[model samples]
Target: MIANLLTIAGTDPTGGAGIQADLKTFSALGTYGMSVVTGLVAQNTRGVREIHPVPAAFVAAQLDAVFDDVRVDAVKIGMLGTPDVTRAVAGVLAARRPPYVVLDPVMVAKSGDRLLAADAVRELREVLLPLVDLVTPNLPEAADLLGVPEAVDEDGMREQLADLVRLGPAVLLKGGHLTGPECPDLLAMDATGEPVRLTAPRIPTRNTHGTGCTLSSAIAALRPQRSGWPDAVADAKRYLSGALAAADRLNVGSGHGPVHHFSDWW
Candidate 1:
């Protein structure tokens, strides 16, 4: 059986994030993964050194090729490096309208290095935000995406996440980076919906490279084989928390390092 999932994101040479991490997550979770590369990134777990975005035409073409041939049950979008790439991605998502779409709003790396330009943030919100089913933004990324100054715990993270909900799609405000030993990954839906908070003990490790991409992709892989949004988020949280716990034992880079996706994966 071909359990196909598509990852439309940038390329990560370190195999820690972007398309590389998404594909690894899909495979680990028993989905045969296909990818549409939007940008070419040069980096390790430490940080992104360079980014060369694929041409807009080529980016759209890649998606066209995949859609024309593959049976994609789910799709994950990440790291569209430029406004052009973002527009291209939005177009593909609108056209294909896959059953499950997970959007990881990858603006900056966990190391605080810039993966996207300041101006491209507007393009993402205007073009891609409404096209996907769900958007997973880490604390900082969520803040940036929502025009909020910062995602400070002292400044009320829940309200910030609630504001992010107005951006159209369901928002999962990942609280892993919140200042605490225990982290809660929050799911804030549209208005009138009860927010679901899935909390997990923060893993004691520094190898958290590519966590957002991995989490969203894992959820995409599970959705076709599982239930709906909240269920998918729960499954993704379980898989990622396990990956984080095994992260320090992984040996992929001299920097933050990659997750050990093969162990205890969904």
Candidate 2:
């Protein structure tokens, strides 16, 4: 078995997102996968219907259980829905201090459903974001964290990237949801002091569920095994684009569907 990469996120019963996507991503990229679910989400590819958070103590215990035994090379975090939940995740991270932490500030789902509590958004900024090594926020999420409303355009996207970088960790401003046909992603950090913009042709389809979780987890898993962050992202971008293209042939849920996790595995 390959060594493990831990995913700390919510559970999606539909197997289209959250910890499900993260695990699939880790497995697809040749790693052992494990999960510590902070919340149980009643969700499909369409949207999140309800969320029931796991008890804070149990969340702690789950984290402790995994970190105690497995040598987790990296971690990918998503959907800590409450301030208390975020705090519990923080406590676990503090205790384990995994080598690489990739935070996918998962505020909204693919089908326009909000995944984060407003109070927890603030807590993520104050408590969680600082401790992470990398923070991947989509355009709208970057806008929300930076206190701006109109980030649907390119100029607005770049401004929000800078604003998010000030919050502590390196910020990866995902521009895939933007209007342009070409998806341009900005990797902004203090060390670079300039946005490493990666532009790719946007794939046109509605079946893109759990993409953020998968992408961030892929980045988390690949970044450690590979040398360069930019290269890792570039390679993962190609991988995900292929996954999305492959998504068109598969059928899952009724709404925005899932990418094919086992496209190359078989």
Q: What TM-score against the true fold does each predicted structure earn?
A: 0.95, 0.96
What global local distance difference test value does model 2 have?
Answer: 0.85
Give all candidate RMSDs, comma-separated: 1.7, 1.5
The TM-score of predicted model 1 comes to 0.95
* Candidate 1 residue-wise lDDT, 1-266, digit = tens: 65799998888887888888998899888889999988888888778788888999999999999899888898898888888888888888888889888889888887788887888999998788887888888888887887767666724677887777887889888887777888887787685587888888888888888888999999889889886888888988899888988887778888888887877633
Local distance difference test values of all predictions, in order:
0.85, 0.85
Candidate 2, pairs of clashing residues = 207-257
Off by over 4 Å in 1: none
How far does residue 198 in candidate 2 sit from its true spot (Å)? 0.7
